[model samples]
Target: MFEQLGLIGCGLMGGSFALAMKKAGLVKRVVGYSKSPSTTDRARQLGVIDVEAPSALLAVAGADIVLVAVPVAATEATLKAIRHLVTPNMLIMDVGSTKADVVQAARRALRDQVGSFVPAHPITGREVSGVEHADAELYTGRQVILTPMDRTLPEQFAKAETVWNALGCRVSNMSPESHDAAFAAVSHLPHLLAFAMMNSITGQAEGDDFLSLAGPGFRDFTRIAASDPKVWRDILLSNREELLAQSRLFQQTLQNIEQAMQKGDTQALEDMITLASETRAHWRMGAQRTSKGR
Candidate 1:
């Protein structure tokens, strides 16, 4: 068991991690800090943390494990705040979605102590975000991707994997660059599309009317648009290069379908739709098999 968990950013992700660790009996105490004092207070009141820290540095002061769950944009500053107290034995990890940028931030802020930092992204979250929304089961059965830097210590990396695995997570490792590129296509671009789709309909004169008539499909497709704006804004901007590349590819496919529609090429459109349908079906089956195996 860990002596203490020094939690920074005490929001949904951080609070959830604290709760999960507590539930798993992995830590004795959790000291949490957030930019907002009220948030830290709420987290403590909610029993997500045992102690409240005034600053990020103080949060790390007597803790054996630290979790930096701040927005991607604030990662460097947060790490810098706690860098003075970062020890070789401490296991530090972040829940930032974008890996390469976070890895770069760790290198700049932690310098030689970067070896103790492991960049991680847990592939799960709800649309709502807050300490109040924190759930101990958030990471359960989730896929957690660890992007350990070249300077990362082997023991620390192993510990990170063990921690996540103990929390019922399926842990996988990938290089930061590969992690960023893959997630840009799968996660970031999808959120961008959902945001754009919502705006495209709402920006029209009949926007409200359209929304009023929207059914389950529309609601399902646009659900991600309701995600925390600031969080997604940082994620999109942080991985813009790869996200933009994926956007271009999506646009090309969309244009091809639009062209077929405009030309009244029923067979071409049918062929394209069939291919997409089959691909999606095959992927779903494969995913089910993998989940079952796990």
Candidate 2:
């Protein structure tokens, strides 16, 4: 077990990780820091942290495990703030959704200590955020992707894997670039689309009326649209390049369906619908099989 865990951010992700570690008996104490004093205080009051540090550097002073759970854009500044306190034995990781930007930030800020940094993205969260909503079971049965740099030490990586495994997380390894690209399509792009769809209707004159008439399909589709704007803004910007590529592909697909509708091609529309139905059915079957196996 880790003697101490220095958590930077102390929000939903960081708070949840600290709680999970404590619940699993993997960490003895947690020292947390955030840009806002109230957030740090709240974290400590909620038992998510044992101490509230005045700064990132102070939080990580004697802790060997540091979790940089700040926004994607704030990662560089957070890393720089504590780089001087980092040690060779320290195991540093982040909960940022995008990896390429985080890796770049680590390389620039951590310098020689970069080898101890293992960039990670936990594929689990809720529509709500903040320390108040943090849960110890957030990482249980969830997938966490670790993107280790070439300079990363094997033992450090193993320690990261061990901690995540102890928390009941299914861990997988991938390159930073691959992780960014894959998540852009599956995670980032979907959030963007949900936000866009909600805006499209809300910007209309009868938006309220339309929403009042919305059914379960609309409710389910727009659920993620209620996510924190600031968090998503950083995520979209960090993975902008990959998201833009995915956007273009989505637009092309939309145009193809639009053309089919405009031409009144009933057979073409039927074929498109049939293809999507089959693909979704197959996907559902595969997901069920995987879940059952797990």
Candidate 3:
């Protein structure tokens, strides 16, 4: 519930957020800006925003809330662009994939006003991007994590939760460091593995043939590989340290499976597969239960 919503980066994530907030009747007006003039124009035409500001600074002017949905690498620049316009009463939040880098960016750019900045990661998106693909239901039944800093104000934090919750998101809180570490293992590593797997297949001589014969399993696993490369590039690099550790762990697991097969250890291979299958099934059922409860 705010008089104005300042939206930076009028792309898929930002556009979807604006639409969701509008659907929830949470904001009176929305002012949007994007680096690409055409994108801002498109957002205005699509009714994702009420007005397209000429610049980032102008977008946040007089707004009670600001949502930064730029790439993780550009967080600092976005923050710097709007820092002068921020006030203590305004609630600032980011929809970044990584938290540590964004937290650092907020501290560097927001300075004394950093207490109003909240770093958030919504665990939901499609392989496709852009405002054209934005949907008001995008965040429905999704998990949104808030990694608030020690300096973050209680009022701002509560407002951030209220906004996301109004949009039908399940909100959870954690430290920025813990957020990065956990997501690196579950989210980042999976995307990287999918990308690597697709590349490995395509680099082979029978790549096209293999793809032509690919079934549901291959299709499902590599679906995320079809996501916007530029977005994934920023995410991968932003959490490279934790991703590297996860990568090493995956490599070791792969080697263990390979060794088992080479040694004709059927039981070992079966055990590994069984563990994965059972764990996935259990997790899936738990998630279904949670969704039903909601």
lDDT of 2: 0.90
Candidate 2 clashing pairs, residues 3+ apart or interchain: none
TM-score of each: 0.96, 0.95, 0.96
TM-score, candidate 1, is: 0.96
- The C-alpha stretches of model 1 lying farther than 4 A from their native spots are 285-294
lDDT of 3 by residue, 189-286 (tens): 99999998899999999999999999999889888898878788999999999999999999999999999999999999999999999888778411
Model 3, residue 229: C-alpha shift (Å): 1.5
Residue pairs with backbone overlap in model 3:
none
TM-score of 3: 0.96
Name the better of 2 and 3 by TM-score. 3
Root mean square deviation (Cα) for candidate 1: 2.4
Tens-digit lDDT track for model 1 on 162-188?
A: 899899998878888988999898889
Q: How many backbone clashes does candidate 3 have?
A: 0
What overall lDDT goes with each candidate model? Answer: 0.92, 0.90, 0.90
* Candidate 2 lDDT by residue in tens digits, 134-157: 999998988888888888878788
Task: Extract clashing residue pairs from model 1.
Answer: none
RMSD of 3: 2.6
Cα deviation at 9, candidate 3, in Å, is 0.7
